[model samples]
Target: MSRKAYSFVRGFSAQPARDLCVDRHYLLCASTGALRLAAADRVWLLPPARAALIEAGHPVRVDLPQPATTASVLFDTAFTTPPPAPLTVFDLSPLARALLAECGQWGASEEPLTAYAETLFAALAAVTWRLAEQPSPVVLPAGRSPLLRHALRFTGERLGGEIRFEEVAAEVGLAPRSLARRFATETGMTWRATLRRMRVLRAIEELSAADTPVTTIAHRVGYTSLSAFNAAFQELTGRTPTEYRASFRP
Candidate 1:
């Protein structure tokens, strides 16, 4: 019988211009930028301090619309234990971050990689075990009503651009006002509120390890003015963008 191998890699930067398809039980830690993973049924948002696990042989499209740096590990199903959930999003602990950094340094050392991978799995499993004490993970369900789905998809595509009611409504075949009402009914937030939340989530990902200026991050996430972005960021996160970045940085 052919034996399967454990694999680890660093610095994965999958561009949004092309679809990145993978065929392994993959786990990834993104240091910067919002990482979107689209599997057959669900889409996961991978932000800093959060990680994603994808099952083996599952088709997934990994999208990072902006530049991002990440470390990933792949396990061939023939050799590794799989997560109970098909796809899982879990909080990254400080120890988990340290483990990932050490794993990155291990490079192509197969024995060390295997050791680290097994330890990583144990840590992740421990986290899952503690879910009874922790809050539920941040995740969004994919299926939605036809009009609602189209509008949300349009909003996601235009995250850094202006998301207007007129355009989204037209694309979804609903009047702008009716669409707004339905969106709130379905998602429990108004269109503008939802857009702001999405923008802030994207901003948090960019703020994770950016060497760029805050104004640039603001512009990159679609705020026209620095002040507006600051207020919005603070409102959503209870800390300004600068403060959030500082907390993450050593």
Candidate 2:
């Protein structure tokens, strides 16, 4: 297995645009603007004080939503353990950022730089683990009714299985019609839209661990047809399943 690790900084240019084809998992922290990951029309926003854990082989179109400075560290599977996923958004601590900066300056020197880089890597790993141990803060959109919380929580917990709007409504003690209206009003997305997000997140998690067949992943996330699963995955990730897997391999 080929193992490589390095650290660097990125300053966004005017009209920034780059689609990175990563061969290893990458940890990135932004100092300004926002980092957006697009899969078709869907976008995940990353702002400063946060880090984005992009999985190996995931073809991501990245752009600075505004002028920004980003510091990043890349590590292959040999150098770092694969993170638990849908891609992780971690709250970056000041100490962690400073350590990363110092590591970047070391530039592969053999003695002191090697020692410092090792220590920095250890700290980074510890910080990432601590963040993962914390619970996710669910952010409900304004105008969303309290009733929708139960349905959302249920979907999140059962993302590995098939979900239907009727089932979600029944679980919440509402008719499908009423539930649909309320869900749209409160969440600003239909139940189907929410399900898609959940499924995509699940797929990302699986992809990070190992190269499982896309069909298996699609089924695990509740798609009955492989073609449909591929379509959905590409529509959201802007890359085919094979392309995503290839990015992580050495």
Name the candidate that leads on TM-score: 1
lDDT of each: 0.65, 0.64
Off by over 4 Å in 2: 1-3, 14-18, 39-42, 108-113, 132-250
For candidate 2, the TM-score is 0.49
The runs of at least 3 residues in candidate 1 whose Cα sits more than 4 Å from the true structure, single-residue gaps closed, are 1-7, 17-24, 39-43, 75-84, 102-146, 156-164, 181-188, 205-210, 219-228, 234-239, 247-250
Residue pairs clashing, model 1: none
Query: Which residue pairs of candidate 2 clash?
Result: 39-236, 57-247, 57-248, 144-186
Worst 10 residues of 1 by lDDT: 129-138
Q: Which candidate's lDDT is highest?
A: 1
Per model, state how many residue pairs clash: 0, 4
Error of 1 at 210 (Å): 4.1
